[model samples]
Target chain A: MPNILVVEDSPTMRQLIGFAMKRIASSRVIEATDGIDALKKLSSEKIDLILADINMPVMDGLKLVSLVRSNPAYKDIPIIIITTEGAEEDKKRALAIGANAYLPKPIQTQELIKLVNSFISQ
Target chain B: MERETSIGKKADEFLQLFRKGEEFTHEILKENERLRFKLAQLEEAIERSGDEAKIRLYEERIKFTEDELNSLKERFRQVEEENKDFAAKYVEVEDENNNLANLYVASYQLHSTLDFNEVLRIVLEIVINLIGAEKFSVLLIEEKTNELIPVGAEGISISDVPKVRFGEGIIGTAAKEGESYFSENIHNLHNRGSISTETPIVCIPLKIKEHVIGVIAIYSLLLQKEKFSNVDYELFNLLAGHAATAIFSSRLYTQSERKLTTIQSFLDMLKEKPRR
Candidate 1:
């Protein structure tokens, strides 16, 4: 089963995203509170895909994306930015930094499921 | 006759001797007068040289005093400049210290509680007391409705406020955009009709990670405040992250605590029941 990492600070949001990921695919869902935590997890376990939020405390999503993209080992892994920063510039910047997709918050469960499914299947 | 002639010759010789002696005495007196005149001239010259030496010494002393005075004046100017520099530096340091203290207190009060209502109250208090915001409101976004609802308010009646949907008004737009909105003159903005024109407005989004959980609407500033300063913006940014995170964390903690208590009660009930 593919191991998916969900990086979000809020516990409620993390639970919501975890639930959606489980319903869509029978994959291993790992939760991380922030980008720093996510990086620690990535080092220990194999993460196939990453879903990240933008404005976390220790390290934000953009910094995480840049770090991941710069690494030789994890550069090819797909990253999806799911954040409340829904501005056009935010989306453009995320895509420019090597994110595979940008999804705004208050996201529909089906859309998230479909997005996660598409990436894992590929 | 011969004897008379010899006596006359002797007298003539003696008269010649007396004439030579008189000539020698006149020459000696002339030489003595010349020596006295030369001694007087030498004494006058020595007195004049002594007066000249005294004048030269006084001139040197005057020059030295003037130089010392000028040096002292230069030292005074340097000291004055240093004092001005130190005063300016002290003010800057004091301002920086005050800002740091404000941030420290704000962080402390924000994290001091885990109760949702207490968090809202503390945030409001910080905005009012620390930030010097006179009129403001704290609005949380209803996740289901995606609407901004006022939870706490000051200097304005709660009834006077209108319902704002997400991305609708200034407060809603700030929450929707997940960015801060500061207007020195609210009358110039698109949503002036919704806000009071008595003072400027600043809308800050309270965000946890990327999600904007709430918005802080500042309608007016204190009388002492003329405009928003960089420090005010810093405080706004602090509120955006720290305040939001505090509220979100507290809510989650309370919810989890309740769930744990419920689970513990369930276990207790099951243990009391007959073994199955």
Candidate 2:
């Protein structure tokens, strides 16, 4: 099973995303309410993909991406960012910081799954 | 009359016989009571056996019906499972197709807009996705200086675009050759001391009228060092040509607008002339 780590601050969104992923990809899903929690989970378990929100307390998604890329061990793992930042500069920054894929929110469920699939396909 | 006389005589004989039959009537009554008691006993036996028979028959029917219901429920579950699997696969395939459509839409954005900046941006992005290149750039030739100007760039980091040259830089060499060139080492290709960093890259010329008008360079990350293939060369060449044509149209529009404004001003100046 490909392990997916979902890092979001909202509980409702967490459950909804988890439910959607579960029905399609029968893999273990680990949820973290904040980036700090996500980082801890990343340390303990092997994660194949990450679906992260941009704005989160404790540690934001951008910072998490930088941290992940900076680590040699985690750099190869594909991270798909889910965010409200639609600006080109933001996209540039995200890609520069080692985000493999990006999706803007109020994300269509189909679009989100496609982006997810692209990363996990490798 | 004779027949009626015979019937009346028989009736008188029967009445006389009935009057003498009282002793026989008492004996018949005793036998009828004994037979009535035996009939009631037989009816009780049937009532007890009939209930057992009816219950056994119903229980057998119920067992058969319950077996059928269970089979139906099992079939329904199997159908439901198959339906769920198909629906999930449909959703997955549908999402993939929509992205394919979206990609086409994004690609079509290049052919629609004549805006130079947006066109360059769209084409480079499409090519980037198409070729799976780590980075890409589009440099339009400045008409006056003949210097390649980086109008649109993505997937690479080499700024100082507005004041860049064409003859001596990697782009300049491609322009001088008037042919698409690929160099794995950009630092080896560029000796101008202009670009300080050493990175592996590919440089291609965007040609028009058999004259090199612009240059394109794609760079991979420091890790990936695969050189550009013939396919990348051709794809980028086509994209760059379309982009250059769009640029020419936009530049033409701007020039004509300037001329129109100048003519209008000249006509206004004539209106201010005094009649002799």
Candidate 3:
């Protein structure tokens, strides 16, 4: 059972992502309003994977990815960036900064689940 | 003496005859031996031919089995490919199911509240999350002025949004005509940095039993949403019906509450009057 941390600022978007994550068998979803809340959750819970939105209010997804990569204790955790549809620069930067993969919005739930499952099973 | 010579010649002739008969019998025995050797060689050749026939039969059987095995392998490959195709199709159906579920939830949440502000918030949420609209406004028709005014919005301030008179522009026309309008060239109308109300991609009229109350104007979609999807259309239909009812109900409830408060205050003032 992998614990997935979803970091997004919009309440409805966060809820939608959380709803999609629930379909994954034996997976637990942890919600955070922004990157700062995500770090807080990371310090407390044994997070197996992270799904974060690129644009957020406090400390965006890229900053969180860089921070997680630089840290020794949580450096190995997989991060999947949830990018806007045509934001190629954000996708490239997220991957370059040690993000495992990306899922664009209007996200396909099956695709998101498959990507997570792959990372979790790794 | 002639009789003795003739008898001696006769004896010599008989001796020659006996020697010739012995030579004839030796020739016959040599011919019999040659025939026996030829018979043995023919029997050996027949045995070798029988063995070659059996070997040829076994080779044919092996070849047939090999063909069957290859055929089975080909069938297995096809079945595997078919299984892959089915798996992909199943995922597609599942994705579609999830999208429908989102629409259900959006509809459910809209009607779950009686607060006007809460209803507006739900509308905004549905547009952002389900419709993927980045900039939009909920404009209700003002009763006295006959103009559509922005009551709630996202990605644009309420003050920034201009009021549209009845049947004036795209939004006004949509509201006045009580019909939804979707832009044909939405792909080319994407603005990168700033938000604009000049060109709206979609305008859905909120109606209650053919009475148009307001309009949901979508100026631009999120950067990722290059085109509208089937599910988005479903969501718009849902919003047109459910959102309108929710907003109308909540506004009525608030108005009723205010009226009750006013009536209660009037009674209190009468009671506090100097025993008149």
TM-score of each: 0.58, 0.39, 0.82
Model 2 chain B worst lDDT run, 10 consecutive residues: B191-200
**Interface C-alpha root-mean-square deviation, candidates in order:** 17.4, 12.7, 2.4
Judging by TM-score, tell me the better candidate of 2 and 3. Answer: 3
The per-model DockQ list reads: 0.01, 0.04, 0.51
Every model's TM-score on chain B: 0.80, 0.47, 0.80
Q: Which residue pairs show backbone clashes in model 3?
A: A85-B224
Q: Per-residue lDDT tens digits of candidate 1, residues B1-276? A: 899999999888888878777777777777778878888888999999999999999999999999999999999999999999999998687566556655666777788889988888778767765565667888888889878888888667766665579997777788899999888564433332355622327889999889999888888654434455566777788999999999889889999999999999999998896977
Give me the runs in candidate 2 sitting further than 4 Å from their true place. Answer: A1-122, B1-107, B127-137, B152-169, B185-200, B221-234, B272-276
Which 10 successive residues of model 1 chain B have the least lDDT summed? B191-200
Report model 2's TM-score to 2 decimal places: 0.39
lDDT of 2 by residue, B186-254 (tens): 444322223322222566676666767677665442112234434344456665565556556766776
Model 1 regions more than 4 Å off? A1-122, B1-33, B186-200, B274-276
Model 1: DockQ score: 0.01
Q: How much is A75 displaced in model 3, in angstroms?
A: 3.0
Worst 10-residue lDDT window, candidate 3 chain B? B187-196
